[model samples]
Target: MIYSFRNSGFRDPETGVYNQTYFMEVFNREWHRHIRDHQSLALLYLCPHIHETVKQPHLLEFFMKQVQEAILRTTDLVARLNNNSFALGLFNIDEQGTQIVLHRIEEKIELFNLEYGKKYTSHVDYELAGYTCTPARNLRIELIFEDVESLTHELEMEKNKHIELRQMQ
Candidate 1:
């Protein structure tokens, strides 16, 4: 049987990216597949820091477009976890490979800022938490998720401190 996404609840309405539910489902399958195939998988959590005042629907769309362009492989998947946060699943990639992809994404955002920075007065201060693992008997998805979530939260806390400092200055 073929599955259609029209009513599948697998996509985010706002960003048109895969939803968390779809990501989780795919992640489980991919995990086992990697174990069987002896491949690697990388997950990246990205938070793009768009100033609260500059919130725009089109901006998010543009960011996601940039993300798609940055992804090296057609097999990689990008999903929207929330308005400002996104998750990327990179298949057949090790830790070093994940860094290369992350760098490319950062470069794209830098170029984007060069074009829109003047008007928006806010750049993409991204917080990226990445993990790469070969599927194994001991690999626990929850632990990886917790680590990334904690890292993302730490970055947010740091960003908030800087924002407050700038406001006070």
Candidate 2:
């Protein structure tokens, strides 16, 4: 996250993490830097698939906490894209590294839910789009976010289709 010593307004008021505006600035800078330096960059879109029936106000905050904790490296960034959705930027990491970070966050959430039991419920699904295994493509940071969001939406559709098919069975 690009921290401006000039002002603290870049941070999300709720999660105390970088907001989308700050994230975009950092993403533009980082994308250029990565291109010049031949480094890897990845962005993960995390969405908490919370149903409307589960009205837990603190759920998003708690998940954001888990995300903030999981991304320990100063180079990594956590941003609140909106309510119940977050964006994590991983620099100097390829697809494998992104998966590792995702799993780490998942494990943390699982442990939290296990300990809290029925009183609290925490669940999330994520999608990742980043540099290819080969670093030859030039892409925009916004496209990465858009790609992941589209993939996540498609996955949700497939999952719902499966559920309907099973019901018919």
By TM-score, the best candidate is 1
Candidate 1, residues 1-169: lDDT per residue as tens digits?
1346684588776566788888888877888899899888887788877777876657776777787789979888888887778888888987777777877887788788887787767766777777777777677767766667776777677755311100000
Q: For all the candidates, what are their Cα RMSDs to the real structure? A: 7.4, 7.2
Which regions of candidate 1 are displaced past 4 Å?
1-8, 157-169
> Cα miss at 140, model 1 (Å)?
1.4
Provide backbone clash counts, one per model: 0, 0
For candidate 2, lDDT tens digit of each residue in 1-169?
A: 2346655778876567888999889877887778778877676666666567777666556767876787778988888888756777788777667667766776777766665556655445443223322222455455666666665566556643211000000
Alpha carbon lDDT at 17, candidate 1: 73
TM-scores of the models, in the order given? 0.83, 0.75
lDDT of every model, 2 decimals: 0.74, 0.63
Task: State the displacement of the C-alpha of residue 63, model 2, in Å, after optimal TM-score superposition.
Answer: 1.5
